[model samples]
Target chain A: MSRTNPNAIRSNRTANFLIYALCGIIAFVTVYPFLYMLSMSISSPDEVVKKTIVLLPKGLSFLSYELIVQNTQMWRAFGNSVLYTAAGTLSNIVMSLLIAYPLAKPKLVARRFFTVFLIVPMYFTGGLIPSFILMHTLGLYNNIWAVIIPSMASIWNIIIARTFIKSLPYSLQESALVDGASEFRILFQIIVPLSKPVMAVIGLYTAVGIWNDWFTALLYLPNSNLHPLQMFIARLLVFNYSSIDPGSRLKLDSAVTQTGVITQMKYSVVMVTTLPILLLYPFLQKYFVKGVMIGSLKE
Target chain B: MEQVVVQTKPKAGRIRSFLRELKRDRQLLVLMLPAVLHVLIFCYIPIYGITIAFRNYRIGDPYFALGAAARWIGVQNFLDFFKSIYFSRLVTNTLLLNVLTLVFTFWVPIAFALLLNEIASKRYKRVVQSFSYLPYFVSAVIIVSITLNILSPDGVINNAIQALGGRSTYFIGKAVYFRPIYILLNVWKTFGWNAIIYLAAIAGVQQDLYSAARVDGANRWQQMSYITLPSIMPTIILLLILNVGTLFASNTELILLIANPNNMDVSDVIGTYVYRMGVVEGRFPYATAVGFFAAVANFILLWTVNYVVRKKTDEGLW
Candidate 1:
């Protein structure tokens, strides 16, 4: 690519090396925190507080993991998170498909009105206060349905689906209609089967979103039993510090010893909550990039 | 032209055409009904929910009866919010955070995209890109927890500071450190993911332009400045214009986690403020009023900035 500029090649080579070095350092900075957190979780509680552990654990211990296992709330929150992500993503894809199919059809009547109706929510909303009141009025507050229903349909997903479906040649659907297939049959058997790629991308994206959301649980569900995994992890890390027992307090008199058990416990919890999603990340990554590219293509 | 077309058509003929199209697409329209109803109840009803900002809303009042029993005091809620002592503080803090975010965080991704584009090895580039994109998927709770661990008095960051002969301080609790820490973490979290869009734009640039520049004896930096940067300017401007709308927006979780009572003066923005007022204190009307004003300002700024960008560069989000 650079053969035309022979005289400048040497200087460009040096610049390229610098760019590689800089990006390498940035990648290190990005991954170092999680590695350190993992190291802390596995290291002995004493070593974690004394700051002896950096990239590797000084002494292995499963005490934090044992504590997490003994806690029932942790398991309950995990179940809630799984339920929300699985059910929420299914609803989102179905709802998005229903809306996107009609909007994608050129022969559909009132297309302008329907498209604008869907697009308006992207710009403005009722604001937080009124949204809360509306939820409360609907009897959704403190119910599991609160987390599921409001987020059921995403307009951006609809747009992406519409674009993907519209990109297909019109004759594909026309032939299906010529075969005496009804619109419903064509949508389910033909358009949907052909939409697997977009559907998978949107599904993975929405699942990641629902899995990581803590604010909805914080606002709608005041009951501790109903809290999601994220909310539970947040409480342990931020709000529960004062609840350490007197026996632990005696050991915490030293500056290094003060944060021994709870700090390690928090690290372990972070690993537990994020490890599943991180494991699923590589599979979703290619589709994630494709989803963004599909979104950015001009209408 | 549309009006002229409509005027030329007979009324019965226009109705007949409409009925024909509707009958042809009835199944498709029927499939859209449930989604439309969902949006109507979930999204559109919330638009009418803003009326609670004007009324003295109570918990027991039925939603529809808000107009009748919940005494309408015509902007009194808004007046109280504007007259409150924290009004300017909230406004200033919100604007300061947004401008600081734009100045510090916006360009990092563009630069990252350009640097990545310059890398010679595709394998090495993929490794670094994947690592950088990892944090954007991490939850905010986990990110803040990591920050809390690393920035603690005896944590890695302060340990390094101590090695350099500086005393350790509680970083999260300090009002002065709030903005820098917030902006820095946000930059780290978003820069890689945001760069994907710019990378896409760069990929779309015509290869012939670069070839032409190379043939003209332009060096690498010169070619980048003249060819690549000019090509991606529209994408950059479009994103910038969109970002201008969120100048008043702040992430509530990030602020809520990092802020203590000690640092509230600097860390408290409109989102967190409304959350505390409405949920914790049950001041629904007042919170609604303050939030509505902020949202209206945001919407107006979105259109105004988009209009200005369109006028100057002939590119806007219509």
Candidate 2:
């Protein structure tokens, strides 16, 4: 309803202004870091060393990006991250769908028992040490399987997928059953095609999770060759930055010391590791949001 | 004889029905096989492996060879942890870090969602919400790196401080700034993502109620306080309970990345301690004991909070 009274309009205007101002400030705080990092990464080493660049680039340079491109180790880690994310997400989706489809069916015997069986791990675990020990015992240590297999299924995602499947017209499955379609056939041919939205939600979740994970690599993949892009970035940005003397590294050019290049590389590495997900985020934001919404509709 | 016949008949029928159900759902069971086997190997085995806390377990020892092969220590690890010099400090640090984070960061998303709901323009609201979620998608490594860069002695914050005629402070190097920096980072990363749920809850609020409130001459603040806030209270309480349940857990990864010798006293939490002890130092049994204690504490806190919430308001995670 429209209000014509001066006081009503004045108060509404005040409230609207306050809300926009607050939200704008919050949004700026959230986004300003990425902007700063981007600007810092591209800024000249001189400006970077002087700490002159804050919100915008000065004497913009592509030197760090150039160095990062030529860095074979970073590229290898990038390749590893891609492979792990693809394998992990595929496994996650397959296993989640497999378990969720059965759980979705009311006619499936002991569905409640199976659901509880899966969910109990969410509440309690053997903690990190035992899991580490178990990994070594299973001979997954220093192997890529260590990273991909353990996180293949998440009960939360399974529940979300199951909830989506349960909401579909049961008659579709019923007719397929009458047509003598096996449960596997119905899951693959009938349920999966209709369940693309939920699959997207879970797939994106798993992909992002695998993409961002470094602790798994740190714990299990002691082999530096198997490190993901995140672990590589972490090494450059967090672990070795302070301990190792940057000046000792081979210099790219005389314009900047190894120290300055290393600083710029730190920002560049973060962008490199982060850019893929951030680039895909807008296109996939809805599915991510849908995942959360579906999860909230708890079983 | 009649009673025996009655009992035996139902038992026999139940067994037959169970077997028939199993046969009919065999395909579904087959589908569930991979996940079931995965969990048994990865999850349940580790759970059984938790028994190492009670054994005199060492690195390279046979983990599963229990009884005579692995010496039984009978809660010695637990006793050692309790009696250690670091016990009180670790407990304090973990609780303080989490409780402080909970206090400072929990209300941010709720406030953000409420304010966004108040915005008249849907387009502006959408843009603001989208920007808010950017940091949440970024890896913790990146976030910590950014934090370090901004807080470094020669970084932006210190530069600003010097420009403003103040002495530059090594923020990360000091124990005092750890909590605020961590809490701020958590708020920045989570506020937008967490707001999605509250926004969803707010969306479910009946539009008719708002219209009615308007007709009754209720102001915006009054409507929010009287109608909107109460409508989303269940969601708010449910989330709060969940947050309380995780009070014993810290952002171990972030802590590990950020903590240094300078701030170790204040920054060392149970997760970091366990990581250092078990993984780094190879004190597997000791670290496992510490982790198990934390896990039990977390479980108890979650259940207690859930129980208390259900008692008071009939809202809980369960």
Candidate 3:
């Protein structure tokens, strides 16, 4: 692949540089919004609204952070989100492992029927209304379990766990059976210990889904005080939108005065709601990628 | 696809042997029950709600079948949806948005995987890969909030646009720019993350092909064109078909967060529309009608895609 023409060679190099530079520029643009949010969160709200800001903060202040952290509602939402995510992930893993262990073996009756039955729902859903109504019927409405219970067993995770379990050395389980070990003991002692990586993957996916789940909480946990961080942030954004309505200036100011949290303050609170997630991926990046790789083709 | 020929003749196993097997596999059932129940309660039970699509659904009232309340308007809800003035707009916008997203978010990740696979510098690749993958972890709430900050008139992005001697644009307010911006953000957040799958697929491609091609004096271009792309094509097509299955089921959170009344004409997808109908208006029956309609549409699309893929590629989600 030798270049026959000098002009072509020069043009190719320029094109290559331009392409890489353009990709770099696109990456910058993609990341800039988050960077802007970080800067706004640290800036004085007054300076932020003037629309005269630059790459750097005019004056660094953590008023929004301080306010959001100290706000009892924010903490409550944070606590609820954590409780939901942890509980949801744990429950999902336990349930998925339970299903996978049986399915991984070839001996179950109605094996194909049950497997297909389980997989079908992952591809389709009951939609929003009935699911909401179902929660109400199940006595989960406005309860913390509203978020956790509905999503306890995930078909995708179960399939992934089953696939991994199927890939395991069967002789180990067979030998355990030969040694007169009970099924429960083998599962707890051997399979569970061996499934850490996939488990981490399942836990990561479930945790993220739960952590970012405002919709479930939005529907089931209607209590504003019991709202997860996402729901709370959504309310704040809506509150900001109303305040920023380009109606009478006096009305806008009055709305702002009533809410007390400025628009920029809402942006900062977004950071607070998101900071945990940002901190999460860098650690689970390994397990996360592996899980995606393992589970990506499941569909 | 040729269905797995599940021979129903329970290949005569001695009761003693099956008992041995079941006793052997009883551990399996114990392990599976919790997961099966989780899906049973959360996923399958809710599927019972699909009946509401055919019924005159009420929140607390007794259910009636297939338009029984209004004299069995068979396929009328779907007909109404088709006749609705917004139908064309909804379909067009959803397809446009998905196609654009497929180009950037879906395809670029596959290409990224190919490129990342080629790089000789492992350290550079690792660092870039790590940074690229970081965006997917950021919650939609934060992603949209951050985008809102940038898109707001007095926000830094607007300021930058204004400083460029251009009129400050209200990015979200314009219906025209909504799809582009939505696709852009989606691609930004997902492409690198989505690359993980393709990266895995490419890694799993048989290395013997590469060595043989190189032995034949094939350059990187030829090697990639002949070897890598073909090897990962199945994965690409599989994912493409899956994405198509959900073309109508847009991410409600992203759509809801980014949508304002100004852009509703362009941004209103079935998912967000359902939420707005039920959650916002509390029109339970009507929203139920719409939700079930969307679910049916999704199911049809999925089945159609699977049928086509199975017929064409002999590989599909069965």
Candidate 4:
């Protein structure tokens, strides 16, 4: 067919139009829930109860934010989540880098054995009951370590890091070794300095994972105070606020106002727990895609 | 004498070289200590504790301690699990839920990626792609929360229905709606994120193939089917095998959040069953046995699929 043939041009236009329409619809569907939640959270309680707020806020009010601010448990859980994400991500990066660095080296003895050792956990686990039993036996139950230690090293992350490190020129390490640098010095001073991209990828992934996790918290940490923000949000949204303290409940003069406040607060809870990651998503996206690509292209 | 010397010389040299490598890389081994210990203490120890499935384990019984109360019970726990009222229901629920979810959600990302790859405008494609990834970053709690609110009796969907002179359907409170809601939510949360891999795969397809196809009078659809799809077939097959491997492993976190008494008949799976029996009811041995059975089945399924795929085609995870 000629480049400017009318029929061909028209067909191309038709295909492009269809692609745009489908892409737009899928994007809207993906984003609609978040938009709906934001609109509901800010919309006036009366309007919310009337079911008038669908996609946009009407008679905007910050009442839910005010109530969430006053809820001490929410704040505590938020603080705990922040702490866990920070500590857990650090531990994950350290452990992953340590193992990955050694495994990346061709000179490492028993490289294949170590690779299989790490990969085995990905395919099989001891199941929930035995892990839980082990947690109690180790005195990690109801403690912060229970949240951090079990997830200290992900085999997938280690593999990603190892792949990246292997891609780095082997000559750099060789030169450093020739200059009388120890392996530890070479790894920490040379490799780690040049590994910012992989570090960022692993860091963002670990932070998001630690932030979003609630199941681990639920299993090991029976203490409500130790619960993370996601766990708190889960209790509010799923359990109907049954575990919420009575004092934290919105004290209103009428039951109607109280229920309206509670309903909006649920939306607010969802937003508060999720907004940080969503806001950081644009920056997180590149590294995450990079991480997944690296992981998928494994040797 | 010559035969003995030939065999012994290589064996001795191999051991000597291994020892030399270890001595030279002692610092690297030291660096590996933390991770090695972390795996040994956390992973392998728990693996060793799988023996609890055979014991009459209770809440405070010492793990692996051969006491009178926690003595060996052989496969009694497994037998009890097999004979239990929930045995069939749990297996059916787990398998059916996963199969339905796979059927409904698996093809979506592939279609999305194909459509996305055809877009003429790069800027618009980027914007749409960014929007699609938003839900993936959201937590399961938030996803379940949004689903519950939208499908609640007084929530938006019912409200929309009621405004249209229709009666409100208690979507969340009905057993029939659980699988649909769960599967749809999975699609919503995962489709865009999952598309990234396919998009990457699509990007790797040779531009020469498309050019040649177009030169031969192949239209856009023809090029997609003959060129793009064939190039990404390996990725598709690999992902399908991996998805099938998890046939018994339902999303326990989401299920626990959404499941209630009203929907328990449909929502109960091996995961939730183990959690309730072990953690809530303290039936450690029984729950352990049930979980072990599920894990073994999953591993076997994965192995069989991989073996068959490798035999039929040259693609396998191993």
lDDT of each: 0.86, 0.87, 0.74, 0.88
Candidate 2 lDDT over B243-294, as tens digits, reads 8988888789888888989889999999999999999999998999999999
Report the poorest 10 consecutive residues by lDDT, candidate 4 chain B.
B1-10
Per residue, candidate 3 scores C-alpha lDDT tens digits across B131-190 of 776778877777777777677777667778778898888887899989888888888898
For residue B89, model 1's alpha carbon misses the true position, in angstroms, by 0.5
| Candidate 3 residue pairs that clash | A98-B31, A98-B32, A99-B32, A102-B28
TM-score of 1: 0.94
True-vs-predicted CA distance for residue B247, candidate 3, Å = 2.0
TM-score of chain A of each: 0.89, 0.91, 0.87, 0.93
RMSD of each: 3.0, 3.1, 5.1, 2.9
Query: What is the DockQ for all candidates, taken in turn?
Result: 0.64, 0.67, 0.49, 0.76
Q: Mind giving the per-residue lDDT tens digits that candidate 3 earns over A64-178?
A: 5655565677778889888888888998888888778878886676577887887678777887887777777677788888887866877788889988888899999999989
Clashes of each: 0, 0, 4, 0
Give candidate 2's TM-score. 0.95
Could you give candidate 2's per-residue lDDT for residues A193-290 as a string of tens digits?
Answer: 99999999999988998998989998998888899988887787777642223332336466454556668877888888889988898856789998
A150: Cα error in model 3, Å: 1.4
Candidates ranked by lDDT: 4, 2, 1, 3
Q: Quick one: best lDDT, which candidate?
A: 4
Clashing pairs in 2: none
- Predicted candidate 4 versus true structure: per-residue lDDT over A157-265, tens digit per residue: 8899999999999999999999999999999998999888999999999999899999998898889899999988887778866444334445753566566667888
Give model 4's TM-score versus the native structure: 0.95
Where does model 4 exceed 4 Å of error?
Answer: A2-5, A241-259, B1-13, B65-70
Among residues 3 or more apart in sequence or in different chains, the pairs in candidate 1 whose N, CA or C atoms overlap within 3 Å are none
